[model samples]
Target chain A: MKDRITGLFYILAVILLTTIHSIELYIGFFVLLSVLSGKDFIPVMKKTFVAVALFNGVITLAYILIKGFDYGYIALINLRVIDMTFMTFLFVRRVNLFRLFEFSSILTYLLVISYSQILLFKRYYTEFILALKSRSIKTPGLAERYGFLRSATGFFIEKSVKNSSEISLAMKSRGFFMD
Target chain B: MIELKDVSFSYQGRKAVENITFSVQKGEKVVILGINGSGKSTILKIINALLFPQEGTYRYRGEIITPKKMKDREFVRKFRKEVVLLFQNPDTMIFNPTVFDEIAFGLRQLGEKDIKEKVHYWADKLGIFHLLDRSPFELSGGEKQKVCLAALLSLEPEVLLLDEPTANLDPRSTGWLIDFLYQLDITVVTTTHNLGIALELGERGLVLSENHRLIYDGNLSEFLKDREKLLEANLIHIHRHRHDDMEHRHYHIHDDFS
Candidate 1:
């Protein structure tokens, strides 16, 4: 379960789902996935739909605007996207993703750094919002809101640049860039 | 005045504080001490209403402070003007264009007419008047902190909640802040891991253990004298030192705060 077999299995499933063109086959696959999801069927399906809704909505709208509406085509495309996303979610939930990537040191390093940066940014974002909330007796006006947004954007951009350089130096000290 | 009755909170499933209970009275200076990750900041956030306890009640001035209660506009207006928190990082609080605007932000938002007077007053008090025209982002860490404190204090809050107020300060700046706070009559609760400077910040101390429970709540100096409590909190550890040209191990509290 921790080896590349799990990764390969998901990759092959994705390829099959992508290459298939038959609507009936997609429906059948979706049903089978629902059965395999067990108690997670509803939650996974909800998350999968939510995840694909915006992208699917935009693309479907663009497709209609460019040409015309095709009901069967829309159903087939939406089904495929939902199924793929659902499978991916299930894969992440069930597998130890770090173990699957243990074969690649560079990947592990990138994952670690990205995870750390995400947590750091999340903390900073909360702090920014809370600081604003604690200081305000009334709702911020539009001009003040714009000021806060600009300042927050500037802060994040500065943080991103500084963190990247620091990470680059740390990686260099470890000789990670040796060619 | 603030009271937490068996307050407990967790982030997701991981507990940050477990059934922690304590109270602070009017015009009292209290310091919360713990090693890093011991929930010192979490308690401050609770007091500042940034986070709420999942288990028990938090009462401020005899009114149960809940999200619903806070939604009342009048209550919010009163609470916002009465309680203020200086975040651990000044950068998070420094979003205004200029130092002057930064100090006047809260006052302006509250529709106060004398924004100029209050901003100038606090800016002069914090000694950031020279940087009034400059952007807050351009200032040094200590200067940025002063700007933020001035902003929070401009509202004339009754309770000041400071989270590691001197974490980024130098010796001189820290001394200045300590002296200024000592003179301020507002009730203050400050969080810090610096055991050496903890007593200077407050007469009463609340110590949080590694498990995120309040292990000691009493006189500040008495808590410092209790070796077992300090050891339990992991504030003091065994140190290997040289005595009379002979090496020996002794219990010591790290003095890196100075």
Candidate 2:
């Protein structure tokens, strides 16, 4: 099954459960998930635990002060905890990192809108390099130019490849993996 | 002892390493030196169990290491407890927010309790106590390496494998790393393109050729003394020779040890 579909099911299930049941049931489901799954989501688990506890504490205190120890605010806060927790967990675990690259599909529109900005950056760099080379005016230095080209190409290729791979892995490890 | 007997590893068609044989007893600091395309990193990966050899055997203690053996989560978990690889790049190995979290990462993975105390102990030991709350990305290169080393040491692995540790560091940082390794009591297998760093950290050196073959294995100081041998191995450079002068033989940049 696709992870996104599974994630969607989890989200819908959490909402339905919280809507029908109480806050304790929601916390029970969370503890169950943490115990069953591999413990790779500790960061999110810690955050969820703290956030849920604080939310419940604040809501209960406000309810006691305003409504005289009534359980009315409990249901509202419980539903919220369920919805937010399920959505955040699924989003962190199921979404692919490169989904951010979907923005590239709008490149044509972006190019049209930012045409002047792009040209200004390109022209400024080109003119600066040309001026620097002109100042050092040495005619046919084949060996030196070849060495420079080799090192420059190697450096750029190494840097780009390293950056791309590092970003991809970082995204995946942070729970940005597709089903 | 750790032994790689007649081990070979191949890619799609080309061989990355072939028929390599070596061993290291407990508490030995071994350095593998090779040029850019010489499969030094591949050897490190093999030792790390990230890559299994295509043929022959890898024996840790007495039992042979194979895919089937490593497939056991219990065994793999135990093996990881004993040996750990420190990657070439700190940014890849460290992904936590603060220096403390980065050091705590491996210990947490191992399911060790009392994480806060362990983290603080290693942080203070490595002199990175002040930087515990600071983000790892903000620290300098030397600080990053120290923090990573502190993280690795917190696990107390018997064998620590380092890959090109000093490749892009300044001389001062490199020297500090060398001194740090010298004081450790674990078995060390480090690969280096830097001859100076290799000589400083290792008592035994293994030189590898471009073809991924072991070319030389011997003492570090004697290896450094041989100019012709170093030149033949593509390790001799002008700066190293000038510093070999009598008055400047010892590499002591800092007198105060700060």
Candidate 3:
């Protein structure tokens, strides 16, 4: 029940923030990443932050000089860089790299956060089911329950296979597992 | 062969592992034994290229192992496919939804085209074919461990680095794991607190001390038989039955820092 509730909260948070603006949404997203991956990658995060800060400053300055900061597009791009840099730094200071990347593969990190979200949901449902079973609820229909289970299972299996292949390809492209 | 020379790693100016040097020849089953906080897992991490040493060198197959070489994409992809590390926690390693995909993960990481056939072969070998469609997270600890083993073994890695693989496993599961490991021809480096499994499966043992330093490296039986020495190293105790006296001789674990 707690996990399911928390999962719902996570979805709501994402929805709420993303609706505000791209910059606010980016900040929220990266903050979550920092909290998740800040530990093991602290040193890496520090280095990445410094590099990204320099990169962001340069890019912002160039945009201001050429196109001016009056337009929102440049600010959005700058906001993204700033958000990523801040999150990377926080992540370096806080989370272990191994723990941060614990659930990711090269591909999983890219092309959709759905894989992680679905995993989180599956775990939520499993806990919910166990709790429900513990309460000794009267079964209305065995076939209906079985059908629900089968569909839930199919959903998980489909996502997992697709995500694994996607992550493998992404890792390969990023020079992971390329011996 | 894999070799680490003068490796040192420090976090926030505090050393985790320092001046460590070790070598494992091809096909050698080396067991690393140590008490908690002894840097045993840290050593494995360095070898797997998960952590870079602040000093010294790590060489694999006579060539230096570096991020530059690893960044080549081809080298790392090949290395990971050939030498895989099995983490202590199966929950961490078994990410796929089912046993089949979980076992196929490492193989697929290596770009194996015929994944279905390879997955079947490994599943059958590990005796988990019936559980193929079952969710990996739902499996028991022993089953999860088997799934993890099947996943790594399917890759056919030449060097298998296991960090306390048998830890928290049931006696039956531990026995099965020991038997499976003994049958493998690949080089196996395992860090374990289980003396029984170590004695049965490992021919050589290396003891890591509280200082995160190597204390002893030699024969498993001979090492286990020395109660006084082992106790000093904070290692597990093992009992031997004397045929002449019909009495059990206990080799007590040593307590370090005395």
When just chain B is superposed on the true chain B, each candidate scores a TM-score of: 0.97, 0.86, 0.88
The C-alpha TM-scores of every prediction are 0.88, 0.55, 0.58
Worst 10 residues of 1 chain B by lDDT: B249-258
- The docking category that best describes candidate 3 is incorrect
> Candidate 3, DockQ to 2 decimals?
0.03
Measured on C-alpha atoms, candidate 2 has an lDDT of 0.69
Which lDDT tens digits does candidate 2 get at residues B28-107?
Answer: 99998877767787788778676778987888877688879777767676777677777676544545567887787667
Best by DockQ: 1
Which residue pairs in candidate 2 collide?
Answer: none
Per-residue lDDT of model 3, residues B1-258, tens digit only = 999998888766877777878899999999998777777877777777766778899988987887686666667766776676776755545445578866765555456798899889888888899999998878888888788788877777888888888776877777788898999999999988666567766899988777777777889889887766577667755778678868776655532211
lDDT of 2 at B186: 93
Q: RMSD of model 2, in Å?
A: 19.3
Clash count for candidate 1 is 0
Report how far residue B197 has shifted in candidate 1, in Å: 0.8
lDDT of 2 by residue, A1-179 (tens): 35446556666876676565556665666666666445546766666667678777787788878878556456657656745674566455655423432346454333443454446445444433332221111221464345334433443455557655775576568665644
Tens digit per residue, CA lDDT, model 1, B152-203? 9998899999999888999899999999999999999999989889999999
- Lowest lDDT block of 10, candidate 3 chain B: B249-258
Q: If ranked by DockQ, best first, what sequence of candidates would result? A: 1, 3, 2
Model 3: residue A31 alpha-carbon error in angstroms: 22
Candidate 3, residues A47-101, lDDT tens digits: the string is: 7667777777788788889987755776677666555555445433543443444
